[model samples]
Target: MAIEWPTTQLEKQSDDPMVILNPKTWSHYHSYGGWGKFFDGLRERKLLATRCSNSDCGEKRLWLPPRCECPDCWHETQWVEAPQTGRIYTWSVVKYPGELFKLPAGTPLISVEIEGVCTKLMSFLKEGTPEIGMAVKAVFNVDNPTNSILDLAWVPA
Candidate 1:
């Protein structure tokens, strides 16, 4: 008896190199672990940051992409509410994004510099044009959360 194989044909896009588009559909289960609180805060319309717990640590600044542990002293970090408003430290217009990008092309990606935060937070600009020193405020998707970093965005303040 002969073994039966899948008969579904893949759509070919290129003829020279024989590039074919393989259709795929599946659910991906992911866990944020310690970073769960950051997403949770987005649901509540709040920006959560992390700081080194050790008082003696020289780096006394908040981390926007909340670090689980201090990179300097390797000490545990604690969650803290970060400033919702910040200035655009830098930005770039993404004309062509990756396959998994949630936003459309031409979206302005920005790095926000919040007060007291040691590092900049990378997020997308939801409205208006982006400038190097433009003031922006955090906007959350509280009504219908995606439970991902997409839930957080920024807009002109």
Candidate 2:
């Protein structure tokens, strides 16, 4: 069997029949800086964070929603993998779902404290009622990662 390849050089064309795209696409973007590593971790199903990079900062552990600088010493931070397991720090039911995270009405949004991280990460509960300090684990939307933090949820561990 023979395979065929395009021979003609392609050029930018406003009316190319083969090229279709959203006519008025809308998108949101952010300059994530040090937190940029978080998305890379998402693609690999890992939870990453950052810790104080300056020795003078004296912060020996990682922090979630990774800070660009240390809160204590104001030093730059380094990326680290936070434990995917945690317990609910708190939760609230959203009556109206946001367009980005289209959860059912009354779906619980949880703040989880992953092991080894000093910050509480906000995510939706996969199911079941949430209780204070309820054990949970990070669940990645592997099939449909929206490239947003909303792609991560929590379920009973």
Candidate 3:
């Protein structure tokens, strides 16, 4: 004899976190005060960095994530445009997306060392398999951008 399952639903809370929230407002905000120039560079399809302008500090390291002060000498920094080309210092492929991130599996995250910059930049790769020490170039999302760091990605040079 075949058995018919009960048509009943349980109205109970489980261990799973609330997957969605509605009737709520969300927005992206940023002062971009110290970093406004950097984002402005992106809008123009250029890469910019900051470096110490102090004369005594022999180190002229270019910082990718521009800083207001030099880490070595604590001197004030100035803006400088960086070349678009660089090499993959190292990278990782995310096989799964995070709860807040909507990326497909196997997406590549890379640390790029620009040609004349001292610091390495963390960015995503657009296509192809990632390899260490491989030359790459920056690709800007000129048409549309969310103003997030996702506006820029890399590709093989």
Candidate 4:
């Protein structure tokens, strides 16, 4: 039987965690605030970052991914929408395709380390080599009908 990928288009406003199951593949959750709200903003073609909330310890989060905790300083964080552009810290060509159903076969997922930040975020390299310290940015796929993580991706800046 062919694998099935369930798609849902709901505006989830609840704080409760949402679960997503796939019989053909691994399952994932809708995720909580650290990523959910930020991702939702991406649907509108915007990016956001998390910052430490501790008054004594002010830390800036990097590469606005779904999960984050203060690495240097353990502190609560807030959200900040970033510019749609950044630089690549490092990347690698996917010569051996593996398990992610969301990505196309043999596609390159570039790991970008945005400028002015100490962290690197992974994104699909639409064009060019897996160079370090190269410019890159988040490219949202709005045409996609599925409300999934694959909807948001990265490309050269």
Top candidate on lDDT is 1
Model 4 has an lDDT value of 0.64
lDDT of 4 by residue, 59-104 (tens): 5555456335566576656766666677766666676676655666
Cα lDDT computed for each candidate against the true fold? 0.93, 0.80, 0.85, 0.64
Error of 3 at 127 (Å): 1.9
Model 1, runs deviating above 4 Å: 1-27
In Å, residue 8's CA in model 1 sits off its true spot by 7.5
Please provide, for model 1 over 1-157, each residue's C-alpha lDDT reduced to its tens digit, 9 standing for 90 to 100: 9989988889899999999998779987888888899999899998999999998899867998998899999999999999999999999999989998988999999999999998889999999999999999999988888888999999999
Name the candidate, 1 or 4, with the larger lDDT value.
Answer: 1
Question: Which runs of model 2 end up more than 4 angstroms from their true locations?
Answer: 1-28, 98-101
How much RMSD separates candidate 4 from the native structure? 12.7
In model 4, the runs with Cα more than 4 Å from the true position are: 1-30, 58-63, 66-75, 145-148
Candidate 2 per-residue lDDT over residues 101-131, each given as its tens digit: 5667888989998777777888889978999
RMSD of each: 2.6, 9.3, 9.2, 12.7
lDDT of 3 by residue, 57-144 (tens): 8888888988878998998999988889999999999877777675577889999988778879999899778999999999998798
Give residue 126's error in model 3 in angstroms: 0.5
TM-score of each: 0.84, 0.73, 0.78, 0.65
Q: Best-fitting candidate, measured by TM-score?
A: 1
| Backbone clash pairs in model 2 (N, Cα, C under 3 Å; residues 3+ apart or in different chains), count | 0
Error of 4 at 79 (Å): 0.7
